[model samples]
Target chain A: MDDKIKMKVQELLQSGKIKGFLGLRERHGQVGPYLFTDGDDLEGLVVGDRFKPGDSRYPLNKQLMKITRGDPSGCYGVLVRGCDERGLKTLFGSGQIKSEQVVPVGIACPQDLADACECLKPYPDERVAGEAAEPRSFATVAKVEAMELDERFRLWLAEFSKCIKCYGCRNICPMCYCSECTLENKDFGDIGSLPAENPVFHLTRAIHMAGRCIDCGLCNEVCPADIPLRTLYKKIADIVEEEFHCRPGYGSPETPPGLNIRGEELKH
Target chain B: MEYRTVLTTCTYCGCGCGLYLEVMDGRLVGTIPCKTNPVNEGKLCVKGWNVHEFVQSPKRLTRPLLRKNRELTPVSWDEALDFTAARLREIKEAHGSDSIAFLASAKVTNEENYLIQKFARAAVGTNNVDHCARL
Candidate 1:
């Protein structure tokens, strides 16, 4: 599978189809994000599956934004898993990146990762490598949903109290692209204090992820406090789906119902 | 048009978390935790996330300062060192060596910290030495 990917990337770069290919590279037994240009060292190119489950995964879309912002006119190719493809769709719909400016080389995730993430779609829209695994159901979300109102509140308080205000969950999220985050505002969330006034800090971020989170589970993986952030955001996703009939990153990047509100006073 | 990431260790505390400093056109832009690092596993604290800011901050002191007439004034290396030595000697003579205390920073090397403790115990004949990590 890696050989096939390397061949395709080499063809793209040699044929001038893309200025660069953003993918993972393995060197000295360490895997990291690398931009392969001119295909001089295609031997190092590999799909991002070297780590075990629950290990931290790099936000490839976040890196894509950096490359695109620097060179908007330049066309680039990026390796995408199912979650990455959805993130790209979100980015495209929000006008963060032009669809024509990027070419995604889709790769399907294995069953282990698919089950670990409890993803509904384990394969990208376009697949060039690996077979699509069976979609898994959200057991964690179900467990949280079964709790009573007060129990849920108490559980969340206990979980959030362990927070160190590190912002790892927010910083690792690819869809959180706001230059001025509301969490940083003194009025919304307290500053220079640990725990950040429980529920306020976590709830504010969870509300923001209502229509944006793609269920990659990266936030939960990157969190140092081992908070069940994925389950919290999954509940928000469910609410958006049930209330507004909007499934984020399901199809094209149409505006989610939360952002599509048309106030009568502002209607032209 | 040039961009790259250099792997380095965080200097905020004793944990020594690993991170990659993103550089573009020779300017430090951002920091990302090293995923392969055994210590952090791609998780960074608030201090590590803002490491790039302090590197080129305008508020950071660029030169040594000495107090002149109750006001801090920029001074040469020789003047600053001479002033520090003179003050330490006068304090040790008047109140005793125990009156002065030495504080070491985590940012310095282990050898440097060892030298600082040595200076406090052997040279000054006092054990009033500590490190910022303790605080």
Candidate 2:
């Protein structure tokens, strides 16, 4: 499977189809994002096995943003898993990156990884590695959804109290590419204060992620404070789905329902 | 075209979280937490997230500065070190050694911190030493 990916990347680079290939490289017992240019060695290329269930996956789309930002005209190839493809699609819909600038080499997640993420689609649009695994539901989300309003409020307050305001959730999110974030606004949350004002910080971020978050679970993984941020964002996704009849990154490239506020009254 | 991530330890605190400094064309661009590292496990604090900012910050002091005529003026390392040593000795002699306090920083290594406390206790004959994290 990896051989096919390497060959594809090499072909893309050799044939001048792509200026670079953004993927992972394992060297000296370490794996990190590596950009393989036309003449660079592809021997070290490998899909990172750092995927742990319920842990944050590397934001490959974020890395792609960096590459494409500087050279918008340059074509680049990127390794993408299910969540990564979703992130890329969302970025495309938002016009952050042109579709022509990217060529995704998709890889499906294994069953265990899929179960860990509780993902609905464990396979990308195009697959090069692994098998399509069954999608699972978020048990925690179900539990939260069962709770009463007061109970949910209390639960979220307790969870938000543990927040150290590290902004890992925002920083790790591939879709969160705004230069100026509302979370930093003094009106929303106090700056330089730990546990930034309970539900305000968390809820504000949740609102921001309503149509943007792709449920990659990177935020939950990167949180030094064990906050169930993924579940909260998942709930937001559900809300968006129910209200707008739109699911982020699931359909063709289009602006998210939250961002596509046309001057029209709702039919309902 | 010349882009790479260099793995290194975060210098902000004693936790020594592992991170990769993203370099583009020999200039520091950003930081990504080292996922495989046992210490941090891809987690970083706010300070660690902004580690790249201070590297190129205009406010960052590039050279030793000495307060001359009530204004900070850039000076040679030798002059700064000599001045610091002389001032420390003079203050220790004038006021009791205990009056002078030494503060260590987490940005430095354990050995360097140890040397600082040792210098305070032995050279100045004072136990008035503390760490910045404690404050």
Candidate 3:
């Protein structure tokens, strides 16, 4: 799988098809996102797996946006799994990054990663390696959905209480590109204060994440307090899907940012 | 065209949460938590996350400032250091060394912090050296 991805990247870089190939490289035993300009420098290129398959993943699309935000004309090849493809799609929908500027080198996620993520679609539209895994559902969201309103509130309060006001969830989000965040405003929850206002910070972000979050599970992974942030955002995604019939990232190559759900149609 | 993450320790506090500063085209772009670091275990506080912002902030202090006539005025490094030394001597002589405690910042390196405490203890003969991030 790694060899196939490497060869594809090599082809893209050597043929001058892409200005650079945005992917991961294993350096000093730590795999991280790197931009490969030279094809021969693909010595440590990887599919983000260090030990377990699909364990080590970075927000490559986020890096893509940061780099390409300055210059959008240059076409670059990016490594993407299902979740990353979704993030890129959402980013395209939001006009943060353009589809023309990017060529997604898609790789299907392994079943173990699929099952772990409880993903809806575990494969990208195009792929170089790995079989398309069976889609999964959000069990955590279902469990929360089954709870009573007050119980749910209390549970979220308990979860949110552990937040150290570390905007890891927001900072790490590929979709969050707002320069002037509402969270920073005085009207919103206390920004610097620890034990962030109950549900305010998370709820604000979750609301913003509506029709946006791609269920990367990065928030959950990076949270030091062990908050189930993805569950909250997943619930938001479910609402968006059920109500608007819109999924942010799932779209054909032609209609990349398929935001078919128009707010103008809402009667309420 | 050049993109790499330089592994470094967060200077915000002494917890020393390891992080990678993502540099793109010789510019600081963002920060990422080092996943393998035992200190943070892929976690960082708000300050650590936004550590790159202050580096490129327009409001950040670029030169030393000294209070002149109840107003801060930008001064040369030598002027600021000399003024600070003279004032320190006066304060130590008048009110004794304990009255002039040295406060160290977490934003500086450990070596700089050690210099501050040493300056307090040896020069001023005061053990009232304290750190902002002292536990």
Candidate 4:
């Protein structure tokens, strides 16, 4: 454990700012989400390398929301990286989590991890662990974007065609916090297709990410087919930005901007 | 400790739909649909749902590159632009106006698309401007 991180955790626990901490713990060589009741166990607060829990992969803003619901006055703290912070913001803006009831403990990830995940910003706004790095570029995404439409579509189809319908992309997305997903809907996506609808199912998810996908790249990581799902979503984000000039979390919270609007919302 | 949702629009396509972007710690993370919006009615197509992934994508192109001896090498925007203009002129002079066709992208703004078509018709002396969406 880094001394600074340990000290911060100690201070947070001792100050009674947080009832507990939820983070990864190495269990039988596999990382799992664990809850910490006190700062006394800083010894076990090791930042396990090569250990990523399913919880970390999923947008858990909803779970955190549940934690703060019953107790209106209590404040809770949780670990967050750029993706996690983005998830929190989207959830907060979406009415799923209470911002005031939670405190964020930021962690900066390394470039290798960022590259492997195709991550853009690997650091949070604030950090209690590790140093932050400049945001990386999505070369893979640009490569796909540079391709002609038919080439791009063909590439995507080839990738999407390999899908086993594992729902791992949705399962690993921290933003996919819904108890009932439309992708899982029998009528919308159907069932027992094994591979599911080629473009429809994936496109459904891509549309669902408009103004909300934090570019975490977890969907790509979780996809069994190694579908470059991030590229499609990235392109969609580019389209949204160019068309509407609205960035999801970069604007005023009072205004609901981006692709989530209709009717008079259309400037055209 | 404050988290909430504000209804918004999907900017990915011509069909504008309503959805909610989740924000926490002043950062974007995920999306949800606006149940009250008329377009989506809490339903989003694939593009609208994944609209947030590109803002901080690792693959975004911040610098222009040009092919040099069959290898893409990073170059200044000016150099790339000049090269492109010179090549286009050479091609037009050698093979006539119809030798080249301009393909526009749906990702560009309306103004940019208009400018592209204008440039194609007047400068390139061709009316063969097409869009990616047409495909």
Candidate 1 global CA lDDT score: 0.82
lDDT of each residue in B26-45, candidate 3, tens digit only: 88989988766668877888
Worst 10 residues of 2 chain A by lDDT: A259-268
Residues A1-268 of candidate 2: C-alpha lDDT, one tens digit per residue = 6788898898889999998898887765667778889646799887876555323347889888877876767889999988888888888887777789999998888888888788978789897777788899878799998999999999999999998888889988898888778888877656987758878888888988877888888898899999999999988988889998877788777776456722122111
- Cα lDDT over the full model 4: 0.66
The most accurate candidate by lDDT is: 2
Model-by-model DockQ, in order: 0.55, 0.58, 0.58, 0.01
Q: How many pairs of residues collide in each model? A: 0, 1, 0, 62
For candidate 3, give the DockQ: 0.58
- Give lDDT tens digits, candidate 1, residues B20-119: 7777667787787777788888789999988877888999999999888999999999999998998899999999999999998887778998999999
Q: What is the two-chain DockQ of model 4?
A: 0.01
TM-score of chain B of 4: 0.80
Kindly list the per-residue Cα lDDT of model 1 for residues A1-268, writing each as its tens digit. Answer: 7887888898889999899998877765566677788799789887866666425367878877877877768889999888889888887777777788798998888899999899989889897888899998888989887999899899999999989899989888888887778889988756887767788889999998977888988888778899999999988988988887876788776666466621122111
**Ranked by DockQ, top first:** 2, 3, 1, 4
* Ten contiguous residues with the weakest lDDT in model 1 chain A: A259-268
Q: Give candidate 2 misplaced runs (Cα > 4 Å).
A: A38-41, A50-56, A256-268
Give the share of true interchain contacts found in each model. Answer: 0.41, 0.59, 0.55, 0.00
Task: Give the distance in Å from residue A34's predicted Cα in candidate 3 to where it truly belongs.
Answer: 1.6
Docking class of 3: medium
